[model samples]
Target chain A: MKHYQAWCFDLDGTVYRGETAIPEAVRLIGQLRDSGSRIFFITNNSALTPQMQAEKLMRMGIRAAPEEIMTSSIATAGYLAGQYGRMDVTMIGEEGLREALEEAGHRIVTEGGEAVVVGIDRQISYDKLAAACLAVSAGAPFIATNGDLAFPDERGLVPGNGAFAGLIGSVTGVQPVVIGKPESHMIAEIARKQGLRKDGMILVGDNYETDIKAGLRFGIDTLHVDTGVTRKEALAGHSEQPTYSLRSLSEWEI
Target chain B: MKHYQAWCFDLDGTVYRGETAIPEAVRLIGQLRDSGSRIFFITNNSALTPQMQAEKLMRMGIRAAPEEIMTSSIATAGYLAGQYGRMDVTMIGEEGLREALEEAGHRIVTEGGEAVVVGIDRQISYDKLAAACLAVSAGAPFIATNGDLAFPDERGLVPGNGAFAGLIGSVTGVQPVVIGKPESHMIAEIARKQGLRKDGMILVGDNYETDIKAGLRFGIDTLHVDTGVTRKEALAGHSEQPTYSLRSLSEWEI
Candidate 1:
């Protein structure tokens, strides 16, 4: 397989499953780094900060700077910053989303903000959801990290940020701007930031619905791996196939 | 104007707006009660108990018995009790829902329930939402008190139980069976309890969407008042008009 200048990898299923790093993916990333290839970690998880993500990768023997991680939270903040110019944001999320907006020089207010940003909040309350609905109804711009309805947890698939966003949307009758995979906002932002062309960028991940779909939507080559969520057998039924499908990173010659 | 044996009135917007009673509605209800008309107050609100609703009506100088009050909570509990035969229920609601379920001899559990009932819960948290989603995904019957997306609050409109139910439904891909206005569930329960036929019942309210629609769907005559929500002018645009449209309850002579 030919190497690309920009290799965007999905963190959760492709590189690591829960706490353990996939050995084949780890070796491939290490080899890509040695060959001076630009590597970026893209994730839909908006609960942890980019630094936390980088630290987790480092523990798995992967060298990653905080800037090398492009979380949905970061992409959302960047989108809002570009459109609204560091406006006051009323957010319902955790440290990751909070830090991303703050890093973008945006103020977080309790009420009457210019925008309402939603992410996965384990501590989510009715009051927070009410406030978001009120703000959105009062003409505040609604922005969501991702549109994933559910995510795999210890107990099975649990409600995600998209579910909460859907609640607020149903209440206020306002659709939010989603800034994660399957939408291509994150990929577009990464390409714009790195001064790279879409043709020179390639996305590698396990999930065809989110990671591969994002790459396809962003006009880039996508490599679907059978390590997680979407099995290789599931791809046959889909009309639009990924650019390449591999069993594991070990199969791909870097 | 002729008076009916059964007078079903919508509490919010029709009888009272927020806390204060609409004087015209109050007087009409008083007159109807003096004439020995069967009065039943119907509300989409599942937060307060029937006794509490009766007390609220009494404060507005509108004489109402606890038996005359029928909330979405009561309908939901009744529906569950009849179908599942006092089965264990996992609920996300307040006192109204709790009391109704208990009164129906249904056991309320935190998890591993046969049904998941959702009502208006002001103290709603992520844990509660997660539990509800988990139960629903696990094949528990999903039932919601109402489908009202938002309700008027001190700070404008706030997200209602339907919004939260919508959130859970979006996550689990399971639509909840709504037991409130526009569904005819509550009205059917009222009809069955009073031993009254649909032809003898008359539903009076200001809202065309919930009040009139409920009556129309239940095969009952509906009286639409222009005191709140649906204005008198707005009724002309609707293809299916109410059985009787009046400026206020004061217009009807018994």
Candidate 2:
């Protein structure tokens, strides 16, 4: 791969598959870090905090700092802080989203908030959903961390944050502002935070629909790896092609 | 209304509105009962059992039997019984759904079920949704009691059974077989139970989307009253209008 100032990587399939690390990806990331290229781990997963994500990467033999991690939750937090300013928010998510919102100086209230933010919540309940609907209908801003309909786990693909968001949106007749992949919000926020332009940024991921589309939509170059959800053949249907399509991360050279 | 042997009425908007009985509806129902016309109360609400619905009607001064009540739960149970026979099923609903399934001789399993049934569940949880998604991804037949996206509550419109079902459907990439209004399944089942033809039945209600649409789709006559969701002006937008439009139930004569 040609040198880019910002090398944004997608987790799950791009850096690791489930609990195991992709050696080629880990090696490439290390090389990129050694060469002084700014690395950011971008993940749609809002279930884990940046610290947790960095720790996960570290366990896979890839040195990563919490500051270098850009989860959907973090992006959502940044987006809210930048766009809506400090606001009391009702949330439906896990520790990651809660921490990010609180860290960004937003109060997380149970009800009657200025905004309703939704992320992947394992302890999701009807009451939470009801509260969200009530808030949204009452004119509160509705925001979703990511729009990933499902995520693969040991039990196979389970309902993700987007599914719940969709449910709320359908019920309340209000569309949530999604701040994850396939939307330019995360990439734009990352670029804004780092003081870089789209020309110097390159997004690497296995999923063409989210990662590649995000990069393409953000006006940045994208590299597609076949180790995830989208295979080489599947890209044939899409009109827009990525900058590079590699069989593995090791196949690309700086 | 002209003499129709089978008088199917939608409960919420047609008969009563949030615990208070509509006086005209009560009077009309009483007259129908006195004239020996079979009265069937249909509801998209799967939260209550037929007994509960009947009791609620009885409290509203409208005598009703459990057998005369046709809830989405009952229709769902009948659909499953007729299609899949005795099979293990996963459920995301309340007491009504559980009772109907069990009474229909279907085993309700936590996981590894032959079907995944959804209904109006106030106590819905992530675990329930996750289990449903996993089972559906594993090729379980997905079924929803009704497709009412939202329903009016004390706090305004809240997420209904359809919203939850839509969430699971989005996650698992499976469409659920709805057994409520606008699909004609409940009406058809009711007609079958009464051994009556669609031509001989008339569905009366306030909502055009659910009640009138159900009758129209079932190839029966429909009576629209300006009592609920769809107003009279909104009916002008619909190409297929109800067989009768009344200002109130008192305006109709048997």
Candidate 3:
């Protein structure tokens, strides 16, 4: 029942699932925009660029600018830039992660570097993993875009970036610094970049583990909708409860 | 030291490190062969076939027949053969694993098989991993050739087959049945194939964790050398010690 200055929404299960957009979520987002609330689309997908995500949202009748999207790739780049400034980075990811890192003034290399950043790479090879292991074992800072082990596809659940990062961690005996929920790096990046206070921001998502936990960790209010991953019945299992839990975004009044 | 009917030697570190053979080990193995002891080369490297391993040993002055070499690939195949007879297998590995599985009467497939077998594959791709993850998530049995997380290469320690298997495991929440040194499957295979009793077998290696532990778990005598991993000083940390520890193979009397 409280109005927030910024409404951060998780993209995958909150706004859309695969190719189709949730009508209730789309309608709610439009109402929030009309009410003069800042909208941010946050996602753990490091494969697609902000422009690509915005285009997808536009096709679903949701107006979103590239600057309004905060993907894990962008958050990873921003986190690295803030932590160590611009330096050589060994990267294992798709075009989005590469572009984000390069845009942040970090040089990508094949082997030794100041940091080893990993994301979901569909074209992942053994050589790339070997190089990452070697670099991480050599004491380079290891960073992962997200820690999702498996994600759903048309066929079934498939290996995600977190699985690959876990492999590297097992081999090198080093843990990577994760940049996605529920670590709160992306939420912090959004707050810092937009000059918004955590008290004035509310994260709305369907997943309790990633989205809701992220908001709680970042000291922001969370609204959980039972449209995706976590069902309404599963909320009782978690010790920490979200600020608001609704069956759908349609139940929320602007 | 008592003479045994069978002498099982671990390939890397015990007999040879990289390309060079340990002179003391080579001399002792020759003496053991002359003394009419059955010699077996046991290795967790699933990349190389038994014939290739035998040839490598032969070139190092240790005469070994293909039947005398028991690789993790061969052990895995043998294990699968005994457990399920002949079944369609989804494989993610190199030539050795493929050959061994096929030779054991199992048909290799890309996905949706009775089981999923993984090994050290330098040509590993994300698609292959995705397929394996899907298969395992679909309720197929997951098997790994070895569980060595990292192995030393020319540059440094690189990700091993276990790392990739662990990745798939993380994605599917399935623990792979490892057929390698620490598990005693390879040693069990040698004993079953040769009709040798556990009392008549003695495992020789430098690594206490894998080699010695395999021998101990298999109820056989174990000889640990200090020429490779698990230094003599470090052996004190382990609760279960090897049957015998020596500075070199030259210390053993024929």
**Per-residue alpha-carbon lDDT of candidate 1 for residues A158-211, written as tens digits (9 for 90 to 100):** 899999898888888899999999989888889999999988889999998899
lDDT of each: 0.91, 0.90, 0.92
**Model 3 regions more than 4 Å off:** none
Query: Which pairs clash in the backbone of model 1?
Result: none
**What's the residue-level lDDT of B51 in candidate 1?**
94
User: Distance from true position, residue B73, model 2, in Å?
Assistant: 0.8
Q: What lDDT score is found at residue B158 in candidate 3?
A: 89
TM-score of chain A of 1: 0.97
Residue-level lDDT for B119 in candidate 1: 95
Which docking class does model 3 fall in? high
Best by lDDT: 3
**DockQ of structure 2:** 0.84
Task: For candidate 3, give the DockQ.
Answer: 0.88
Report the lDDT tens digits of candidate 3 across residue range B120-156: 9898888899999898888888899999898888899
**True-vs-predicted CA distance for residue B45, candidate 3, Å:** 0.6
Error of 3 at A79 (Å): 0.5
Give candidate 2's error at residue A124 in angstroms. Answer: 0.4
